[model samples]
Structure formats: structure tokens, C-alpha cells
Target: MRIGDYKVSYGADEAVFRTGTVRVWMIVLFLAMAVFPFWAGDYLLYMANLTGIAIVAAVGLNILTGAAGQISLGHAAFVGIGAYTSAILITKLGLPFIICLPLSGLSAALFGVIVGAPSMRMKGLYLCIATLAAQVIFEYLFKNWESLTGGIRGINVPAPTIFGFEFNNEFRFYFITVPVVIIVVTAARNLFRTRVGRAFIAIRDRDFSAQLMGINLFRYKLYAFALSSFLAGVAGCLWVNFIKIVTPEHFPLHESIRYLAMIIVGGLGSVLGSIFGAIFMTIIPEVLKSMLNIVSAFSPDAMAYLSPLQTVVFGLLIVVFLVFEPHGLAEMWRRVKDYFRLWPFEH
Candidate 1:
């Protein structure tokens, strides 16, 4: 809200951009994003694309676990399904990447329903275990299905082209991801405003209570799973296209845990938090690697400890956030904004 902004009507009170200032800022932000490719280096562009993909996946996980209060450790498997589905269709069936992207998401959503079937009878830790087991089963299938997935060999994806324009470099490809991310993020931000989104939140808060209020526990639970998995699937499709390769080993349990850590660190129930978490999780390793390289160069003995040190730093970052800031970085961000807004005020 602007400093002197006031809602004159109910619609104004509920609007996304309540003030003209925020909308102007948003326009400026998009304008800057539009020109980022021209000014940024290849590495920065790569990170931007990578972060965008992770944001998509993190937001999906946040929807299931954060908004719906459903625990899923099998999220990576859904993403893997998306990647493989898109890759197989593109490679084997000669389908365009654009068409395969949503189709891949739908494929994963189908599996999401199957996996969510256990949710009707399970909750909390039991449900977490069920999803965790699903990951194992999914991974086994990914690894064992040698013919389709290429097994340990992996499959390559050709660079996508649209209307005679090839997205061969990160700069050009940023157009594809930036728009998709914007759309996904915008949809996610608006989703909670709708009845179905409210139903998901109600189920998350207390499924039994939600059921008493006429919300179908089974149906909404599966809906949450399908929606969440579809987002993850889209992320997976983006990953395969960006990386230009699909491997069974790419989606592992640690990756799933990493996405969970991201949402938790970013703030579970916030859309912006997903983007924050994805950026932090993706960039930190690169930051740690850079620091470690300097240390290892000065002392070769430190080379042996590089991997474990980075792991320790990552674990510590999560532990610090969980222990002292359970609400995550989004809460921290709000406090900063509040402080700025209330500057010069007296207690």
C-alpha cells in the first residue's frame, strides 16, 4: 500500500495491487527483466534460468506442503515424470516441446492422483512416509526402465525452436522461462483468492474440520496433489529442455529434500517465498564452491574437506532459519518493509 492509500470499496481492499505505486513498480520490474539478457553475462543468465526453473518446482512443493499441509517427499519423482514424459515424446514421437510441456504435466498429475490415494487413510507422519516410499518406487522405475528412459545412459534433448527462431543460448532462452515463470508465479499468487484455493488451505489447516464444513477431503486432497504435481512437471520439462539431457539419476531423494528446505527457508505458504528459497538454495552452493576454491588454492590440504564443508554450511543455514526464523525469510522481508514504512515513528 502507498503511504496515503485508502480502500474506498470492498474490491479495492481485496485487490492485488492496492495502490498505483505498486503497479508502477511492477511495470518497472518487468521492464528491467525484459532487458536483463542484453546486459547480463552468460553465467548470470544461466543462473537466472536455473533459478526460474527451481522457483517453479519450489512453488509446486509449497502448494502441496505449505498451503495444503500435505507432506510429500516424492516431489522429485513427479518432476522426473514430467522430464521423461516430455523428453520421450519429443525424442521418440517427434512432438514439439511446447505441446509436450503441458502434456508432460498432465502425465505427472495422473500419477499424483494415484499417489494421493493413500492420503484418504493417512495423515501426518504416515502420509509423509507414503510419499517417501512413492519416491523410491518412482526412482526404481526410472532406473529399471532401460528401453524408454535410456536407463543409466540418459537421453539428450534438442534445443527448442519456435517460429524459425532457435533458443540456442541462455539469452534467447530466457524469453521462454521468464514468461513461463511470470505466468506460473502470477497464477499461484492468485490461486489462493479462489474457492478451490481456499479449500486447499482449509484442508491444510485441518482436514477433518474442512470435511465438516462440506469440503470433500479425498477430492480436494487429490486436486491439491494434481495441481502441485502439474507445476513440478512443468519445472521438470523446463529442466530437461534447458539442460538438453534427461537422466534417471538427476532426480534423487536429496533433490526432493532440497526443494523442501527451499520452501521452508523461503516461507512455506508464500508464493514470493518460493522464489526466494529457490534463489538461495541454487546460489548458495555456487557461493560456497567459490569460497572453497579460494581456500583450497591456498591450502591443498583443505581440498579433502571441501564437499563436507559446503554440506555443513548448507545444513547450518537451514538449521539457523528453522530454529530462529521458523516463519522463514518472507517474515524477515516483511519486518524490513514494516520498519521502513514506520520509520521516524515514536513508540
Candidate 2:
């Protein structure tokens, strides 16, 4: 296949597993995951759970911001909605966890469509503001809506069960999360190869041009919002299950920023990047916290200030990456692999 001025070989064009090496790496990854629960400690399993949740959320945001070119600053609101919905459904309505999770996703999708209706008349910063407004409204409702949300006190969530088998331990939850993560990531990757996904990309690149080419910008924009919200809602449901609670404080503005950072740091439109971003962001703080603990042991004054220092460091890292490697860690990996493949051909 030829695109523009470049020629793509049959292997290059058709290949997701482009080489034998990649296939082997994938096999290794599967094997590692299969055995992870046996070897990994409780903390590591917890971290993996966090990574899975983040990856799910990041991929959803990527669908909105990267593929659809729609800026959203309130994705966490959808997550909150999903969590609370699931909690209420299970606790109040006596719905099973299995039914509640999907219901939560559907509820979020409905809200997403409502939010996306205005997207036809808005773009860029305006759309961002609209989403931001939604986020604030959701937070206010969660806090003040005492009858349903339980006000600022929040609500407790029960452990998830599948056919009478309870997933209460981190190890059991890890198994649940890993499979869900893989399924979501695979679905997201394949989404871009379909007509709906292509429409999103076309509209994202140039809405006027897409409309001229027979794509309905308004319909597709709404679709993007629905899909993104669905994914966020699923992530939220999983998150509440992991934490065993649904609190207004869990879905804050900072979480929205973290999701944005994950997509940006991972790679805007790449599925692999979303996973990388989630894992990196989730683990980095724990690593830093451990280092801080060691420092605190030696200096109590430094210990007292470690929290602010960690925040500063995290902020600095984000800034540096944005400035120097805007394409993100995924792009960086691509460059290194390309360099190796094209070795001795100094361009």
C-alpha cells in the first residue's frame, strides 16, 4: 500500500505483530501476567490494579481527545457518575454487581450524549469549558444530593462476586482487572480500524472536510462522547470495586488532570501508550514515596516536606516531557526501535 510519498510493504501494511520479535515479546507478556499473582506481593498486585484502572480511563480519554480531537476537562465526572450509579444500584435496588456495572456504563453514556449535544456548536476551549461545567455540576450534586449520593459522607461498596465466587482479595481482583484491561485495550485498538472510528479521525482532522466528504460531524461527535463515557464508567465501576467505596472525593479535578497526563505521556492515539502511561504514572508515585520514606528516616524535617516535593517533581516531569517529547514515551520507543532496525544506514 502506498500512502502519500511512502511505499508500505505487504508485511509492514498488514502487520500488527510486525516481526517475530514482537510475537515472542507478546508471548512473554502473557506468561508473565498468568504467573504474576503467584509471585507478586500484595503491594505489587495493588499497584497493578491501579494501573489497570488508569489504563482503562486513559484509553477512554484518548478516544475523546486523540481520535475525536475533542478536549475534555471533566472526564472524572463520568467516572464518578458510574461509580455512584453502580453503588446505588447494588445497595439500594438489590441489583447484582454484574448487572450494576453495565448499568453504570449505560447511565454514563446517556449523560455523555446529553453533554455532547452542545459539542456541535462548540470547539476547542469552549467544549473544554462545557465539560468542565459538567464536572463541577456533578461534584456539587454528589456533595449536596443527600437523598441519593449520601452527601459528603459517601457510600460503601460491597465486594464483587461472579456466580457466588467472591473476589475479595487483591490476588482475585487482579485476575479480574487484568482480563478486563486486555479486553478494553484490544477493543480500543480495533475501534480505529472501523467506520465509526474512521469517522471520528476524519472529523478530528478537519470537521469541515469530513462533513464535505459525507460524514455527519454531529452524530459522530456524539458517538465519540458516548464511547468515551462508557469506557470511563466501566473504569469507575472497577475502581469502586477495587477500593470498596464510592466517595465524592475520589473523582476530583486532580484525577481528571491525571487521566489527561496519562494519555499525553503514553501517546495521544496509541493503545500501547495508554497502558504505558497508566503503569508509569501509577507506579512512579509509589517509587517516589518509598524513596521519601528512606529520606524521612534520616531527616524528619525533610520527611515533613516530602509530599510537596513529590508533587513538584511530578509536575516538573510532566512539563519536561511536554516540552521535550510531546509525542510521548510511545513515540520515543518507536524511535529507538526504528534506529535499531535501520542501523548502519546513517541518514
Candidate 3:
């Protein structure tokens, strides 16, 4: 079979199960995830939780920026809204964590719709500036809204409970988070096949042309924003519960940048890229810290220099990846796999 410029073999034309290898890999991956919490230690489990949360947020950002071609400097703000809303509901309103979590996401979605309304008339840097303004406004609200957000003091988030079972430890949280990550990623993957998703892609490729083709740019853009915010909110809610805190410091502007970096470094517009990007970005710091610790063990005097070196290394990694491998780690992985699979048969 052939589609567009690519040739498709017997298994490649299938919509869901494209190939036997993919199906097997999916099953193996699912099995590994199911058993990971039981075997992993506290530190690994903690990292997994962080990766899961990042994946969710990155997926949302990919939908907005990758599929819709909207630049959002306020992605973290929606996450903050989700966290703060859930925290307040749990701490003040005495609601169940599960109930409040979804509500928090809903609240963020509503706010996203409001923010996106202005985006209908804005484009390019102007739209980015608008989103940045919302981010600043949200930060101010989180900092000054003492009655709800607890001001700069922050608020404690209780451990999540599902049907009387509490996810109080890293292991338990890992189980909860991993499944949610899988579900969210799968949903995001399938979304791109739907009409709204196609509209988003169309708008992304050429908004004016998409509009000329009868696509409702305003409605679809608003939908994209709401969907993106909802996912971000869900991630934020999970993060708050995972960390057991809701602080303004947690949703800093740098975090928004980090999320963008995750998508860019993972592969924009790809679900697999989002997941891999989250995992790589989240774990790389820990890996670096371990390496630094080992170096310090050999020379205690070098400990103070490690932090700066780590920062420099991280920046360099980003720059190098952008300049040489802008398609990101996933793309690199794909190319490497293809090279090996085809062996001496060069395309």
C-alpha cells in the first residue's frame, strides 16, 4: 500500500495496530508499566510520578502549540489554577480529592476559554503576549489571594484517595500516576484522528486557508485552548497531590518554558514524543545529580562547582539538540531504529 509520499507494507496501513512489532511493543510496554511500581524503589517511583505529570502537561501543550500552532507562555498558569483549585477544595471545602481534581480541571478549562476568546482576534507575537499577560495575572492572583491560595505561605495538599485507598507513598502514587499517564497519552494520540483534531492541524498548517476551507477558526481555536488547559489542569492536580503542596513557587514562569522545552526536545505534535520528552527531561536532572555526587565523592572540593556545571551542561544540551536535532529525541530514535532495521539497504 502507498499513501502520499510513503510506502506502506501489509501491516502499515492498519489504523490502530500498524504492525506486529508495534503491537508486541505496546503489550510489553504496558506489562512493564503495570509491574514498575512493585519493583522500583522510592526514588525511581518519585521520578516516575514527576515524569507522568510532565507527560500530561506536555501533551496539552503539544495540542495547543504543535497542533494549533499557538504560542502559549502561560501554560503553567493553567496548571497552577488546577493545583490551587484542587487544594482549596480539599482543604477548605472538604471535598474528596477525586471530585475536586476533575473540578479543578474544569475550572481551568473555563478560564482557558475566557483567555482564548481574545486569541480569536490575535495572532503571532500578539497572541503570545496575551497569553503571557494571563500568566502574570494568574501569578498575581495566586500570590495575593490569601483567602484561597494561602498567599505566599502555600497550602498543603492531602494524599489522593481512591475508593478509600490512599496513595500516600511514592509507590502508590506511581501506580496511580502511570495509569493516568497512559490513558491521557492514548487519548491524545487518538484525538488527532478526530474532526476537531483535524481542524486543529489544519489551523496550525494554515489558519487563513483552513478558514477559507470552511473550518471555524475561532471555535476550533477556543476548543484547543480549553482542551489544552483541561489537560494541564489535570496534570497540576496530580502534581499537587504527588508533592502534597500547593505553592505559587511551583508554577513559576520557568516551568512554562520547561514544558515547552519538553515538547521541543521530545518532538512536537507526537504523543510518543511527549511521553519520551517528559521522561527524558524529568530524569536527566536526577541522573546529572547522581553523576555530580559521584564526582564529589572523589573530590569534595568539587561539590560547589557541580551546580554551575550542571546548569551549563543542561543549556548546552538544549542548544545542541535544537541546532542539530530539532526533531528531538523521538525523531532521533526513529531514525536510528530505521537505520538498523534496513541495514545495508540505504533508502
| Cα lDDT tens digits for candidate 2, 107-159 | 98899999889998999899999999988899899889999999888888889
Worst 10 residues of 2 by lDDT: 1-10
Which tens-of-lDDT digit does each residue in 1-347 have in candidate 1?
Answer: 22788778999999988878779989999999998989999999999999999999999999999999999999999999999999999999989878988998999999999999999999899999999999999999889999999997788999987777888889988999999999999999999999888999999888889999999999999999999999989999988999999888999998899899999999988998998999999999888778878988889777677679878987998899999998898999988877766776723
Q: Name model 3 segments beyond 4 Å from true.
A: 1-14
Estimate the TM-score of every prediction.
0.97, 0.93, 0.93
Model 3 has an lDDT value of 0.87
The lDDT per prediction is 0.91, 0.87, 0.87
For 49-92, candidate 3 gives per-residue lDDT tens digits of: 89899999999999998889998999999999999988888888
Better of 1 and 3 by TM-score: 1
lDDT of 1: 0.91
Runs in model 1 with CA error above 4 Å? none
